[model samples]
Target chain A: MRLENVWLRYHRRGPWVLQGIDVRIGPGEVAIVLGRNGVGKSTLLQVAAGVLRPGRGRVTDRPARVGWVPERFPADQPFTVTRYLTGMARVAGLGRAAADEAVTSWTDRLGLAAFRSVRLPELSKGTAQKVGLAQALLRPPGLLVLDEPWEGLDAATRELVPELIAEVLAVDGSVLVSDHRGETVRLPAARRWLVADGSLSEETSSTDETIAVVEVAVPAARVAGTVARLRAEGHQVLRVRSDASTAVSQALPVEPPRSAGAARPAEPPLGMAGELTAEQPEAADDAVESAAGETR
Target chain B: MSALVRMRLAGFLRTGRALAPLLAGLITLGTLYGGGRAQPAEAYGVSAVVLFPVLAWQTKILLDVEPDVQRRLAQVTVGVARERSAGLLAAAVAALVTVAVALLFPWLVGGVSGPVDPGDRSIPVGLALGLWAHLLVVPAAVALGALASRASVGGAGYGVAVLALGGVGAVVFGLTGSVAPWLAPPIMAAARTTAGDAAALTLLGLSGWALAWSAAVVGGYLWRRRAQG
Candidate 1:
């Protein structure tokens, strides 16, 4: 999808929030929009998602299906978790049985099954954010646009955010997201688009060698073994924090860490890291411990 | 589109925003029929006149039922055009329900007696004419409601003003009988025709005028929405 020469302003006479913004993202690609608050990052995401029409120019080659999750989910409505997700699934063109199946699957996958009958207005911010993600994922979207998706998420769900993006990318769907928090650390390979002065500039470097603070989540029982394994493999072990959530995140650099005097160690084996992503709630049975360490 | 309409109607009812206009409509219907039985044509004509503004109010409430963020999500799910069309269709459906209640309320209250002064038309014919008159005014009221929606006017106070002016304007301008009666819906003409022994040709002309006015108002709403986007 491409936004060609797009310019937008909320009001006709208002100052432009986006100007001459031409950008493109192909299938199986991810673009992370970076900007401070009130700098048009959300506007660019909305334009990409086909939610807002550009006053001048147009978004061409947009996919027919777009999943748009706003910064804050509008949970003030009179709908329960199940009802809202089912309604959204149907709105996205799913059949009755398919809609029900999708709702059930997403609610379970997002750890929202317990709140199925709970009204939206009664959900906490993080839980409501989970609902937002569930609705967007009900049907595999051609383009998924998320604005500040990690704002109110719990640590475990925050780790799930990268996995969700990877799932969409795995389907050859283009993903566009705005992240002001350093949550993009997990998305080391995503291309960066900086929004400033109502214009967008692409950061073309995909090979930046910098020290990345990786957050790895593992089952509490395996926390000691995982940290020992990571340290023995020449990766630096950082602080460990335990939480009631079950799942560990691995925060490591996309490229090798740069140190002037020290000999560079071989890249850590990703086989075990991938396995850590699975939610072994029975293993944790109590808490998921996250040892967010950086390899120096 | 069907899903969007269903979602909208469900949201509107669940929010309980339907209560105010519903109460207003029920009160209007009770007042119109409380005195006792009357000719179906005249009673329906008066009901249509009173129901116009109430329907307009109901439509506005339904249109504004969903929050803005959810509306944007719907736009993404089923393109902007379909989402907007769904909103209008839902409003029309709500108006249809209100019309049904208005049509049946008189009968439920024992408000019908016989034919008009000419004493020639059947009960079914009067009821069909009543339904026709209500349906004719629905599209026009929906347009006015769309014009007064939060998307169109922004502020609640301004929205209310627009709705009141549009509803009153349709009646007042239509009553003038000469200068630009076509500018507004032929609501007064409909009431007059339904109340009296009017010819089929005159009723057809009223239908034409009402539809034309609705089309014009809906056109304006579309223009406003496009510009806003």
Candidate 2:
């Protein structure tokens, strides 16, 4: 699916929220939509889902079998979670038995079997989100548009989300999602797009392309070896420090930790000590547990 | 055409959920002392008949059940603009329920009350069709009341309240309280009129208005679907 020169505004508004935005998600490709809040990230997702239309431009190649889950869902009915998913599947034109079977499979996969009888309003946020994603995936829609699919999930389930996306792509389905958290995963690896300043910019990168600039300070004699190792590992390595670190020197600057199931290292980046990552098994676990306690 | 229309009919039949309460309410209404000797135009039973039908139309979409239905309805293929099936089904349910309530309820009530004559059968039919036709306004009201869905503490309570309000309005307008019935629909006005009466203009006006309402709502659905952020 693709949108070209798309412009949109709401209810006698002055300027458009989206201006001349252009994008395309090829079949079987996973495109990660990135943007700040109110930067039209949700709107962009809605347009692709056919919830909203481009005001002055054209949207083409949108497959009819598209599945979408909006950010704020309606939870006002007496429908049980299973009943809800089956209903949607039937509405999407599946036979009743097929719809029921599909719902059963997805609910089991998403770990929602325990909550199947619960009404939508009673489920916790994460559980409700699982139902949302499950409904969209119930019938294996050709195109899946998700708004923050992994938001509010616990660690283990968050790890499973990218796997779910990967599985979808493996079947030749397209996946488009918006996630503020930086996530890295293995399949169909994704191209990123930034929705900003009333427009969308394709921030392109791929698995084969170099992305990181790793500056290293080793013994002058070992610098060449360090650079070679980094290059062989597919890193965009840069040499910032020519001399080795002394006893008092710090190895690298620290940044905020990525969410669990994301790509942040298990231990601190090579030298920050136990407080950072849980790298060396036992001691690392203790430090992580302590950090989690401090957070609480 | 058959698939869409047939689905619409079967979906409309599922609207029977609304009848559960309506039948229960009828039992209570039967026990209550009705305005027994009042003119046919002043019947309170008129409103009671249509209440459940409207309620049924509002809640049957199953969108309220799974996967964030309201957003899906308004923003996805399940909603009216994305597909005609839901909208047509909604309308058919409303119309059928209206006819059933207007004709059947009055006939049932009159039989129980021991009326000698059929007591203005034409008028009740007109009133029912008119009211049923008016129900086309419902989906727009529901879409507008998107916020109410949250405020109702769930959805069941709000659905009941909305049905009551619509039913009450229909009954109140039926009172031959004056030419006021003329403003409601041709059916109600024609009920009290003699054959070839001058009030025939009211029927034409109401039918035109009803048709216009249908066009307006469908048109709005299309526009809202096409509109962007």
Please name the candidate that would achieve the greatest TM-score relative to the true structure: 1
Interface RMSD of each: 0.9, 5.3
The regions of model 2 sitting more than 4 angstroms off are A184-188, A206-296, B1-33, B37-69, B73-88, B91-95, B98-102, B106-188, B193-209, B217-229
lDDT of 1 by residue, A186-220 (tens): 68789999999999999877443334444444555
lDDT of 1 by residue, B119-228 (tens): 55678878887888898889999999998888777779988998989888877887845587776788878888887767989989889888888888888887877776
Docking class of 1: medium
TM-score quality measure for candidate 2: 0.63
Report the lDDT tens digits of candidate 2 across residue range A21-77. 888888889888877778998888888887776787888988777888667555545
TM-score of chain B of each: 0.95, 0.47
What DockQ do the predictions score, one after another?
0.62, 0.21
